[model samples]
Structure formats: C-alpha cells, structure tokens
Target: MPDPAANLASAMAGAYNAGDMERVILLAAQAGDEADEGILALRGLAEQATGRYDHAVETFRQLAHQQPEVSAYWNNLGVACRLRGDADAAEQALSTARSVAPHDAEVLYNLGLVYIQQRRWPLAREILLDAVDCSPGFVEARLQAAYACYVCADNIGQEAMLAGAVNWPAQPAEQALILAAMLSTQGDLDAALHTLARARLPATPEDERLRLRIAAQRAVLYERSNHLDLARQELKLLPLAALDALPDDASQARAEGWRAHAALAMRAGTWADAAALYRRVLALRVDAEARASAAFGLAASCDRLGRHGDAWQALDAAHAAQLEIAREVVPELLAPDSQPLQVAEVDRAAHARWRPLVAPSSRQSPVFVVGFPRSGTTLLEQMLDAHPEFRSMDERAFIHELTERMEQVGQRYPDELANLGGTEVEQLRATYYRMVGRVLPDLGQHRLVDKNPLNMLCLPMIMRLFPQARIVLCLRHPCDVLLSCSMQSFRSPAFMVLCSSLQRLARGYVTAFEQWFRQVEVFAPRVLEWRYESVVEDLDRHLTELAAFLEVADASPMARFADHARTKRFISTPSYAQVTQGIHPGAVNRWHGYREQFEPVLPLLQPMIDRLGYSR
Candidate 1:
C-alpha cells in the first residue's frame, strides 16, 4: 500500500520540477482526498510558476489555512499577492510571516517590495536593512535599498547602504546603471552620461529607450548642476515617437518621455508647448496628477496671453485634483478635522516638550520664509540667500513628509499623545532631527532657510525643531496668489490635482491661512508676516526690514536684494522662472480679468481679501 500523502507530494513535486505544471495540476486533483501539507504547497508553487495567478493565489490561501502555523506558507502567499499587484495584501502577509518567522530574509525582502510599491521609501530602507541583517549575502536587496535612497535624495545614506552589499552581480546593463547612479551622486553628470552610453544596445530599437532614459537622467543632473544648455540638449535627445507608443512596456517609456518634456517645457518658459505636452499625457493617464499638471500648464499659458477665463478653468481643475488625492491618502486628516487622537494628535498635544528645542540662543535661529505657492516666497528666499550668512533651500517638503509618517504611525489626533511618554517623544524628536540632518548637514554660521510653502501648517513642529528659527511668512493679494496657483503648472501631483478649481483654490487658501492664523496666536512675536505687494512696491524698505529681522549686517548683499535675481543659488520651485527674470508686475491682480468666473470662490475669501486691503 503506497502511502497516499507521500505519493501525492512526490508526484506533484516531480511534475513541477520537470516544468510540467499542467500535469502537476492533474496530479493534485487526483490526490484531492489524500493531499497533505507538502502536496498542497507543491501545487501552489506549480500554479504560480506557470502564470496561473488566481489559481496560485487560491492554492496558497488553502495551504496557509490548512497549515496555519507554517511561516513559509504566509510568505509564499505574500509573494503571490505581490505578483498580482495587491500591495496591501502583500504587506499583511509579509507582516504575518515576520511574526511567525522573525529571521526570514526572504519575507523581509518581500515586505520591502510592498513599501517600495506604496512609495514608502523610508520603510523600504528599514525593511531592506533588516533583510540584509538577516542574510548578509542578499546583494539584490541591498542594491534596491540603495536605489530607493538615491531616488529619495538621501545621498548621505546611499554610499553606506551600497557598501554593505556582499555580492553585486554585474550584468552589462546593470553594471552601467550602477555606475550611472554612482556618478550622479558625485555630481559628475557628464561621466554619468558616459557610463550610461555603455548600456546602448547595438542593433535593437529598444536601445533608443535606454538612450532616452540616459538622456533624461543627464538632463535632470545637468539642470541641477546649472548647465542649462547641456540640460536642453539632453532633453532634445529624447525621442518624441516614444511618447505615442502602444500600451506595452514601450507605452510606459513614452509616458515617461512626455512627462519629462512637460517639465522641460515649463522650465524653458514655453508655456503653450508645455500645455500641449501635458494634454497628450492626460489623454493617456487620466489621473489627478496628470490632469492637474496639464490644466495648470494650460492656465499659465492662458494667463500669459491675458486669456483669463481659460486660465481660471485650468486653475480650478488643478486644485480639484490635488484635494481629491490628499483626501484619499489621508481621510482622517480631512474628515471634519476630528478623529481619534493617535500618534499625530499626541505629538501635537505635547507642545510643551518642544520648548527645549526652541530655547533662547544668541546664535540666531534659521529663517523660514513660507507662503502660498506661486507667491513671492521663492523670490524672497533668493534675496535672503544672497546674504553670506543665509543658505536658502527651496521647498524641502520636510513637514509634508513628516505628516505622511504621522499617518503611517496611526497618529490621527493628539489624544494619541498621552500614550507616548517622555521617552517616546524623545525618540520621535531624534527621528525628526535624523531626517533633517541628512539634508542640512552644515548648520554652521550660515542659517538654514528652507522655504517650503506648505510648512505654514506645521509651524508648531517647525518651532519645536528650530526654536530660534524666525518665521517670515509671505503674503500676496488673494487674487494674485490664487491666480498664480491656478496658472502655474507643477511637477508634484499634490498641487496639480487639488488647485484646479476656483472654489477649491479659495478653500485651500482659507484653510492654509486659518492654520497660519492659529499659529500666530500661539507663537505671538515669533512670526513675521510680509505682504508680497508691499515688498515689490517698496523693495528697499522691505529688504532692510527683512535684514533687521535676521540680525544680518547692514552691508549684507540681501540689503541689495534687486541683484538677487541673478546672484542667488538656483532652486527648483514653481516660482523659479519668475524670480530668475526679475520682479514682474504681471501677476498682481491678474485675477481681476476673470472676476466673473472667480466670483464663486470670492464669497468664502472676500473677508480675508478685504482684511488684506484688497478689493474688487
């Protein structure tokens, strides 16, 4: 009498080993009544290898159910979910596998994939670190973690992560990619290009795509390196034909090319051209990010042409897209602003603990010039940056990143704060500084001026981190700021989608302003609000006032702010072009031309507008 369970397992494994998964399925069906854990796992593996994804998933589910304590089964389930593009399920299964088998390197690697797919770069870094810890020889996992760090612009950690890889495989293309990434880090973009050139395939049309990617990377690096002509040439090398490819891997390649074209067009001040490119992209990808970006571009072109109605329409679209994405990503944060006080709430509630971070010091706190997007924040930063003692970094988006982390840690409200004792708060503060330290390595005589507009909402946190930090909030007439936001195209999906509508634009401004008002009430004399109109209307008077706030010497170049448009270091913000070309009076009250279209949002904002001394 053949042992039925062993017989079934042997048959399935034999069929799977031979790559005859169809036979394996038949053997599994015959062994249905006799199938044991080994047989069931074998069937699942066979199904997965043959590309019968659903069947594989079902088989894995059943096997995991039958052997609830088997860690490998859960890990296999996670792999299947990942293959089927279910990131949430993959995370759950990988998490379960971790609990069951704490030392599983494969499970950790799979968990890292889920984080990467969800754009949780920091978590991916941590998980990959764990994977390498579990298995020091896991070279692929180390490489991926290094790549994630590179993309997130965490350059300080990248070399350290890459250094841990025990075995880095060197396929031709992969070798070139590694070299390109390394060159990019060192700011040797031309050398990066030379390395990427090695990736070119001699005869395949796909080689064009490889070339385009190389060119795109070169363009980005050159732009950052301030070689504008070289950047333009690299962008020009990207094939337009790639943008219209059929829906295959090549289609995605085309999409990437078109996206880059839209960005370059905006940078080159070819608004209409950028608008057209965005339209083509939105036709293929109808998401908030694409549509909003395109609409913003279109609005900018229309505004430039003095076509107010069209600009209004485009602006409205972009705003709407951004709100929708924000709500989806953080529902509790949007829901009437009331929710369970979790980690986030607790962090906010423990403001008293932050006093130590802000203790008085003769060493002046950094200057944070914040305002609504498309206002004079960037310009102001440039002027301030010209001073020898000020280092202006544009729109670091640090607070926004922290907000995302808060959500991840289930910090819905500050009531969650009571649960976090002094130790936890200290841990949280250390983590915050760690992230900031990576970006702002040198905090010497030069004060760090991070001019991220959205930091308006996180004034409490900013005060905690840099107690001596001076807050310089920029203000423009509601009409101009709203109009600028509507008209200016953006690369970030968050802005493109939500600020598309006049009503939404107005709502966002009101929301941000209300938050700002709350902060001023708490901080009192710590914050200095500047009106954009006043600054431009009397540059010298305002520049002197600003210098005084910073305690800068009277002779600092910032006192000669008009020269800042050319002398300041380059920053990648939406207002880059406007600041570079010197002050333009065009943006002021351009909203008046489209008054009829914007009236719907005016009622909600009328009081603020009036208070700011602007009127219809």
Candidate 2:
C-alpha cells in the first residue's frame, strides 16, 4: 500500500545516493506536481552540484518557505544563496537557521563563512569556534577559525588552533598553505617550510604553478624574517616579469611575489627598485591590507626619490585603502572628524578630582613614556632599551587594558578615576605588573619602560596606579606629529579612524595634549619633557641627560644605541629603520616642506605649539 509520491521520492533518493545526479533531477521533473519534499530536496542538491545554482536556489527557497521551522531547509537555502554570491541573503537565511537549531554545526559554519566573506574577523572567529564546539570533528570549521584569528592578529588563538591540528598529514594543499602562513607569522620559519614541503610532495612537473607559488611564499617568509640572502634565492625562482591572469588565490600569490621583492628593495634602500615593484603590486588585485601597504611603500619610495607630488598621490591612495578597512572594522568610529576623542577630553571637573598620592611599593614602577604618536617615542624607547638596566616591550597597551577593565565594570575611565580608593589602586597595580610579566617573563632588576604613545590618553589612570611613576614626555612639532600620524598605518581601530585625515589627527593631538597639560598643571607627577629636536641636535648630551634622569650611572650603553637597534630582530614602529642608523636631525624640520598641507590644520595645533615652546 505504498503511495505513488512516496515510491517516486524513494527512487529519487536512491538515484541521489548512487551518484546518478542527472537521473535524480530528471525523475524530479517527471514527478512534477506529484513530487514530495524528499524528491525536491534531492533534486535541489543535485542541481547545486551540477552547476545549476539558480535552479538550486529557487528549489531551496521553495522548501524553506514550505517548512519554515526546518533548520536543514533554511541552512540549505543559505548555502545555495552563498554559492550564488548573495552574502546578505545568505547571512539572513543562516541566521534564521541558527535560531531554529541553536546547536546546528552546519548552520553555524555557513554563517561563519558568510561573516569571513564580509571580512568580519571577530564574528567569523567566534561563530566558527562555535561550530567546532558543536562538532569537535569539524576540521574545516577549526581551520577557518584559525584563519580568522590570523587576520584579527590573535596570535595566541591561531597558535592554539595550529597546535590542535596534529593530524597535519591529512591537510590538503590549500589548508597546508594557510597553516604555513600562520606558522610563519608566529616566526616558526622552519616549520612553515616543512608544511610547504608536505604540500609539494609526490611532485608533478607539469603542474609547477603551485610550486612557483610555494617559492614566492617561501621568499616572503624569508624576507619578512630578515633573511635577505635566502629570500633572494627563492625570489630568483619566481618570474617576477609578469603575473598571469589567474583566479583570485593564484593571482594573489603572484602579486605577493612582487610585493616581497619590493619589500626587500625597500630594506636595501633602493628606492627606484622598490617603487617599481610596488607599482606592479598596485596594478594587481590585492586585498585591502596589501594594497594599503604597497601604496604606503610606494609613497615612501617616491618621497625618498624627491617626488613629493607622487608621494602625496600614493599616500592618498594608501590612506583611502586603510580607511576602507576601518569603515568595515569600526564603522562607528569612522567619522571623518575627530569625534571619538571628544568623549575623552579631560574637562575641568575631571582634572579637579585628581589628588596625587605619595604611594610607595617594594616593586619598582615602570617608566611611563607618553606622547602623541610619531613624537619620537620609538627613538626614545630604542635609546633607553639599549641600556642594560632598561627593558621595554615596545608599545604594549597595559594602560588601555586598564581602561577597558574600568569600562567593563560600569565605570567610565578618567572621569571615574577619582572614585578609586587605596585598596582598588593596589589591586590595579598588582594586575598591571602581572600583565607585564606575562609578556616579559623576567624583569629581574631591569626597569621596564612602557613606551606607548597613545598612553597620553590614560595618563591620569597611570598616575593613579603609580603616583610617583617617572614620566618621559616626548615632544615634537605639532605639525610634524600630525603629519606623521596621518602617514602611518596604525593597528588600533580608533587610531586608524582618528588618523584618516590631517584635520582629525590634529584635533586628536590637540585634545590629548590639552588633557595632559590640565593633569600636569594640577597633579604635577614626576615628569621630564624631552624635546625630540633637542635630542636629535645633541644625541650624546641628551642620552647622558636621559640616563641621569633615569638614575642610570653608566651612560656608556646609551651611546651604542644605534648599534643595539641594528641588532634588534624587529622594532614595532615606523621609525624602526631610522633607529638602525646614527641619530640625525633629518626628520626634525621636515614638516616645513609640507607647509602647504599643514596650512589648513595649523590653527588647530597652535596652542599646543606655543605650549611646547615651538615658535612656528
């Protein structure tokens, strides 16, 4: 007593399971109005597999509408929509699916893919991790979560994911490349190369395209790790003369080859060569970060070649690309004006609440190096770090973490600092030192120098925790600082937004310094104003004076600062390259050349200029 529809659906299901997709689709067409949900679902899957995405989407949409409560139907609809390049529709459908079946790994995985497609790294990372939790054997879900981690710069998360992938032998070529990239970023060069080796095993001579890509990536890893000679050897394998019109992934690898070559040229200080290769990278279809880096590199090379006009053009392109990333990552803070800083403008009320306490502890306080970014903080950090007695993690956000903790506890930072008692302050101090130790395992007897430029915004909180913390206030020409901030590619979302334009950068600078001055005039924390120009003018005298200020008896190590800088594997500042060479007054007055660019933003920085003892 089998029903006709039931029998037909059973046949279609048999055909679908037996790999006869064409027959499954044909049988569904013949069934027509008599087709059951099973037959139609099989037909839709077959159509999707057979490159009939439109038909598949239509079938899935019909099923989804017919059974609104079915999570599978909704998930299928989302997958179909995603395949058809409708991200918005896919997200909507997958969100519905996720709601219908909160524990569905398939639904969560699809939604995570959609978020990754939209460059929403945090969401992608979270959702994909959820998928893995729902189904621990979801290898692809875990791998994708790791990818999202790499993009968001969550190195610890990426490393954990990589560590979990002990079954590396099962990894496909594409997955191997991703793993290699993640490994390489964490500075495990040999392991990355080993992964690439696995990807190229049982070699096929005819398909050496993948091999070339492997060589290019290897070159990039070497170059980025500062192994120039090894990078050169790999670069020789790449035909950098022309990139093929390949698909996105293949094309991107080729583009990266040119970029790696360009970065090497930049390191070698061959401006023309670097400029040419960067132009090649720009011509290719690169991701936003790569495009922005190529553009900035082009600008720097052109600037070095005495091509200020070309440099400005490239800088405009670079900043535009950077702002696009900011728009996606931090849309709320992406206003072209300086609105984000206005919230933190220390008014008279906030400053009036600051009553400095003379606190003492057995543990030595970190020397707080604060300033508007690009005010020569990097240079100061490098010089100080060269001394055997001084150590720095170079731009850790300890203060920012403290600010976030305050906000998380329903207390606004700076404004709420006045409410903290001695007990809370001691707890906070313990937390700060614990966080520092996590990054820097052994402080021993060496003084830790916390050199974060944006720490200017958290000076009040810093003083609260370490009432007698020695502050080295690095100062530069306001115009120069603003210009430098505008030029650099900062990692912080708020900073990226603030530096999107010269006007915004100037406004942030003015307000930050204004806040600092207000706190200083009242609280008067132990501070030294080290003018950047004066430091450049007298490196020896200034270094000695700085050593004296920090109470370091031996100023000899400070004299060899440039040599120490050269030995550093990496410096996390735009001035990294500059520190490798001897001190020069080169960047001191370079802002005058861009007087025209600064003309519009000059008045915004005038009061600060006067405050810092700068005539212009």
lDDT of 1 by residue, 1-616 (tens): 8887777778788888888988988888887666777777888887888787787788888877887789899999988988888889888988998999988898898898888788676678778878878887776676666666654445444655655232344424544666566645543455566666656354666666665666766676565545577778877777676545534556444554676676677677787777777666656646564566566666666666667777666666766665564444334444443321112222333554433432434245557778777778888888877777877655666655655565578974333433444565556666755655655567456777878787777665555445567888888888778766666655343444344456656777877776677666655536677887776687778777877777766635764544665443345665655666666776677768877877788889998888667777
Model 2 over residues 324-353: C-alpha lDDT tens digits? 876766677775543755335446667677
Clashing pairs in 2: none
In model 2, the Cα lDDT at residue 159 comes to 62
Worst 10 residues of 1 by lDDT: 338-347
Per-prediction RMSD in angstroms? Answer: 7.1, 4.6
